[model samples]
Target: MSFASHHNASEKGEFDKPSRKKPMFPVNDRLRAYLKHHGREVKLPVAYRDLQRFTYSVPLKDKDGKDSLWETVVYDLKEWEFIREGLVKIYAILKTEGDLTFTKHLDVARIDYCAFGNSQPFRIRIVNKFNDNYDHYYIKIADASRVYGLELEHILSPNRITFLTHQQTLVEEHIPGIPGDIFIKTYLQDKETNRIRLAKEFVKFNERCFVRLLGDMRSYNFVVDITPDIEDFQYRIRAIDFDQQSYEGRKNLYLPQFFKENYPLVALTLEYLNKDSIEQYQTEERTMMAFRLASARYRMKELLDIMGKDNISTPEKIGQLSKELSDYHLKNPGLLRCHSMGQLVKQHLKVCLRKNLLLIPRLQSRFED
Candidate 1:
């Protein structure tokens, strides 16, 4: 936790963009086994390679006619027949746990391919036949680093993620929220928007990402989930993209407040929150993460054990991040000794949350009472 305070002096930290497109690391036998144990491993009718058979694609555009970085893919008649049915089933698996009872009326409306990011995900739009309603889910080539990021988010954060893997194919339910960049652009300045609550959420969100070693939370990488509560509203910042989790060499890359794209949110935090209030929010987030860790300690231990033994990052990047973290924590020799990214993640978790973990009561209680 001592090291987390260093960037507070500047109110923003500037760092280079991601060094390169991260190579997809295979989900090893151990990770697969863990997924099976947790029921994340399932047999899917389609694989990542199957979707690449599209005949052609048309560039997608937003309402303002701007490039959306996605292309609507068109498949051959036969391929489309196979893919459409399987996709409908995959949607069922994601939303209803493999139940085919309701999939009879469901159909694949469209498939959009995005070549902009690491995973190169295919976004599937599933529509119900009875009405015009539609929903989306993603299919990606499962990278171990991204899987680790998703699992950590599911366990350590206030939100739960639903995803499944079959060999190299990963299916993820679409997380619903206003993209952070959109929210910041359109909603942040609304008179009805709550600046103080948004600022608090950003602070907490920043803490969560750094403590867990997730990175690259630029405004567009996450979403702002606004919920109506009491007489006002509640804001929750959630990381929707996890491609950079635990892979970057730079320590500051893990903190959202440092990214220039997030400067406006950082300015809001600075304007609405004093130093003490910032500390209080950070502490509160860490405490909540501590409780989540406590509740899932055994499962987390298993995941980290598999991760620590795996090679998800290059030795150079691992060493670079390790040394940076070691220096940040007063040159603690333990961080320097960490040989893997997983080791660094585990160590960082302990270092940042040690005090809160100590203070956590043995008997957890619900807030309802």
Candidate 2:
């Protein structure tokens, strides 16, 4: 299947205020209390400062001729809720409405340091100008979000993602960490050793994501956190982007199938640079890694069937797509090489086995009247 096309546009003017439809979830007080009490309870000892009620007097108007203003209360968290536990910021949008969106001025790795990197966060606002209609209003807003999400996801590591809110023009949590591209390009140098390690992790992560039916793994939607002083750049990864994550059955967007049929080939090509017969060092543990990757693919298929029954593409289409994807990989051997022909066959067999195993359970589970 062809990848969808994307368009990037210049950033828009600053929002004067949020729209009325975008009320700060009335749970504001309770959320803060939870953060206050639970923030200290968590292993991560970062402080959560409530910045709500802070006047964000951007120019905002409403459907009514009456004047309305956008207001926001934000919070800054000094570290990740997950790994690395370094300096980070999470802003809670107290309120917003109309065309509210955000754009990044820096890559994920340098996001936390945007202030230091001479990059300013870009804000896009939809105005209630008499000239624009409702349809035009939404079109501008959605296009802006798409560009922001895709571009941002590109700069993040495999496991890192960013959080955003349009209701209050919120760009929550500027995470401080390494970009995924940098990690892939620099740290994952020993072709076979790191390739297999990364593949296993990718499979596992994709499986979990598919089970939940999350859609669209954009390249730059995440950020990686490295230990303050690493001996050799060893660091844990956490996924940050959740904007595209949700239980949308209508799309049949399973995590596993997408990777196997779409992502793996491209991802492997990018990671391995089409290296041939690279040594699988002791650290590689090829067989075990392969198993994990296969398992992830299997889990993904099962998850998809569970989440997307009526919405899934026809069996014929699914088979056609799988074959097409496999053929695509084989045709571009130089760009998508497996260690050897034998290894390629073995890997594909594993994928098939995993896919079948997942399908059997799903079919049986559903057929059981």
Candidate 3:
């Protein structure tokens, strides 16, 4: 199949409306203090504004000469020299805690700007002169919602995220995996692909996003990581873009299985797993998330307190989601009391964990018998 067909499969059509543009939420003092205490705040030599000094840019193309929606930005010699030094120092800070021992051998390969998407991030490619090895990182405006999303992913998800926040800039280490769309188009047809394992992971991933209230996890926003085991391969679905963390009003947006582009994987779930198996996977994921919350009780409490008081979404959106959640949970009084996205998340987790805890004794007795 042509790439066009694959692209068409992943793109949301008229019926599958795209998510609305979410405004960037500023990081307030309380959130900043929390980030500082958690070692996520660091001073950077270059702010995001400094990268805007590019004099010209050329359209970056893929191997097939298709426009990549990225521009390879060019800077004047003097400006390049200054920015290059700062970026190198920033990389050192991100990768080696500012050791700078290997800075001399590194060179800035290319700086590409993506105009699309909420963050409008600048992608930096760094190359090693000696070994010709290369890596990439992203610099974006520091939206408070995205920062909170990254922090939650770090603490709760099976995957660990590395990111640093400066004044108005956020730096994130690149996550390595096949884009979910590409994986569905290409790897799904491979002979050795484990459809059942992939479906199970997607189920767990869906549960994780819903429990955490992370939204807009369309196929393109996530990546599928494949690891080889002794007997077979394993798959993990990780969210790469976190721009919609608890910001949207629709509850379905937080559940990946609801997206049209994810229909192939959803189909796989139906073919491989029965209803009992699906519920079992969901419970397993919820139990794990509850354990993570208990493990990081103090940190989670502080973050939620700050986020509950912050205005990350419109008041109308907060009201809509609170009502939806309350209705879904049979008008739980705790959910009805939530006035902010953060409070809604906290209440949802509380009820979910309480329900799961009640199931534990019955589950344990069955196992013992």
Q: Which prediction has the highest TM-score against the true structure?
A: 1
lDDT tens readout by residue for model 3, 1-369: 011222354554522343568899999999999999999899999999999999999999988899988999999998998899999899999999999999999999999999889999999999999999999999999999999899888877888899999988999999999999889898987989988999899889988998898988888899999999988999999999998999988766777877788878877877788778888898899888766766676798899899999989998888888887778778888787889998888787777767664455543332221
Q: Return the TM-score for each candidate structure.
A: 0.94, 0.30, 0.92
**Model 1: residues with Cα > 4 Å off, grouped in runs:** 1-14, 361-369
Clashing pairs in 3: none
Worst 10 residues of 1 by lDDT: 360-369
TM-score of 1: 0.94
**Candidate order by decreasing lDDT:** 1, 3, 2
Task: Please list the C-alpha lDDT of all candidates, in the order they appear.
Answer: 0.89, 0.30, 0.85
Q: Which window of ten consecutive residues has the lowest lDDT sum in model 3? A: 1-10
Q: Is candidate 2 or candidate 3 better by TM-score?
A: 3
User: Tens-digit lDDT track for model 1 on 224-310?
Assistant: 988999999999888999888899988988888777778788878878888889999999999999999989988999999999999
Model number with the top lDDT: 1
